[model samples]
Target: MRFLPILLSAAILAAPASAALKDEAGITEGLIVVGIAYEISRVCPDIDARRLRGLSYLLSLKSAARQMGYSPAEIEAFIDDKAEKRKLEAVARDRLAGMGAVRGDVAGHCAVGRTEVARDTNIGRLLAPR
Candidate 1:
């Protein structure tokens, strides 16, 4: 019975801090682009790079928007915004190229079989569309 009060107090204290962090750390369009670019640069081979980059960007944006408390409608609206998408795509492209230059054969090192890459990095799971 005594432990119950302590637990409740702890929960109360933790809740506001978590809420504050969520509010402050809302996902940005730039972040979604860079995240997708980074993930694709790490895992995808050059042969499949363009397709994987597009898919990864959409997945990352959806996941990040949901995490930041955006509603489905809002997410759809954001997706529909062509200007935003174009900007993000340009940023993603640049970041991907930069990563390629710096990493020097990222795909050669990291692009194992899909099953192996999935098992090793868990990136397949993270970037999968929900």
Candidate 2:
């Protein structure tokens, strides 16, 4: 949906810069997680993101990647890579769609967010009632 592309673009901007990170699975996964939480929070009026937790999680992801020997430049370059950005965006979009959140469907997104929060899913943990 239109909303989804905006979310994906936001996620891409927030993602690492540069070409691509070297085999950093956590970084990729973490970005997707952030993107998912971000989308749910974006479309759900009654919900809010665990902003501090999300930021902390993002920082930790970067830190972990650093520990794993990926330089800041490498991580940045990875995300800056158009193909990599598209790949991550596609994954995030698919994940949301899989959960029944579609473009222009506010109710669907809210329902999914509520369900996730109620179920205490990882995405749920990153969201809460406003």
Candidate 3:
């Protein structure tokens, strides 16, 4: 009976350390942030994707996730998951839309991109002036 309390306490303390990769905000949100930068650069006339930095950031995320116990297959599946992709894309689209992006208006996207760039945000870190 005495050992039971200690066991429960140990499990409680250990639970958070073994948390899943998907729950890690840095890597997961980094994907969305980087994706936003890439999309903005794609449509924004004055913006360009920082190709090497983007690639390196992604690689670092993969490495960090793996270090946190995520398997390569698991990471790939998360990255490729259609549902997750749609969800993240929707979020990105909403963010851009909120910043004045319109379907056919490159200028709007450019403005948003330039603003993000000027702010030096996570999204802007993946983009550069064209």
Candidate 4:
């Protein structure tokens, strides 16, 4: 909740001027991944410790790619590379498993809340590639 707002604000403020040059859908997916990661980190830290860390790494890669002025096509090519895709998929799988194992309604709460925050802020769309 508190963290979500802060994260969204930071993401918006820290975006590079060339952010618009990256793929919109790709960025959106990355943002969603980051949100889910954050939620898992906070709500189910004991589930899969590496899941959040891995997602943070992926977000960094995207941020770096944008800062380096990579076009949307180039960014997508890098992210979609077999090796990179595998890493992403692995992290996603781990996160999903964690969500399933979490106790009580924490997982549901985190998912719904984070998703609403992401959608309301439109952080991904704001950085849509040109």
Which of the numbered candidates is closest to the native, going by highest lDDT? 2
Structure candidate 1, residue pairs in collision: none
lDDT, candidate 2, 4-94, per-residue tens: 2343333333444554363566778877777788788888798888877777776677677678777766654565566665677678878
Candidate 3 pairs with clashing backbones: none
lDDT of each: 0.40, 0.70, 0.67, 0.45
Candidate achieving higher lDDT, 2 or 4: 2
List all candidate RMSDs to the true structure. 15.9, 3.9, 13.8, 13.3
50 Cα displacement, candidate 1 (Å)? 13
Leading candidate by TM-score = 2
* lDDT tens readout by residue for model 3, 2-110: 1112211221122122225657788768767766777777787789888778777777887888898877667766665555556666766777778798655789878
Which rank order by lDDT, best down to worst?
A: 2, 3, 4, 1
List candidate 3 segments past 4 Å from native.
1-20
Q: How close to the true structure is residue 105 of candidate 1, measured as C-alpha lDDT?
A: 50
Q: Please state the error at residue 53 of candidate 4 in Å.
A: 3.7
What TM-score does model 1 achieve against the real structure? 0.37
Candidate 4 wrongly placed segments (more than 4 Å):
2-23, 67-104, 107-130
Q: Determine the backbone clash count of candidate 2.
A: 9
* Residue 21 displacement in candidate 1 (angstroms): 16
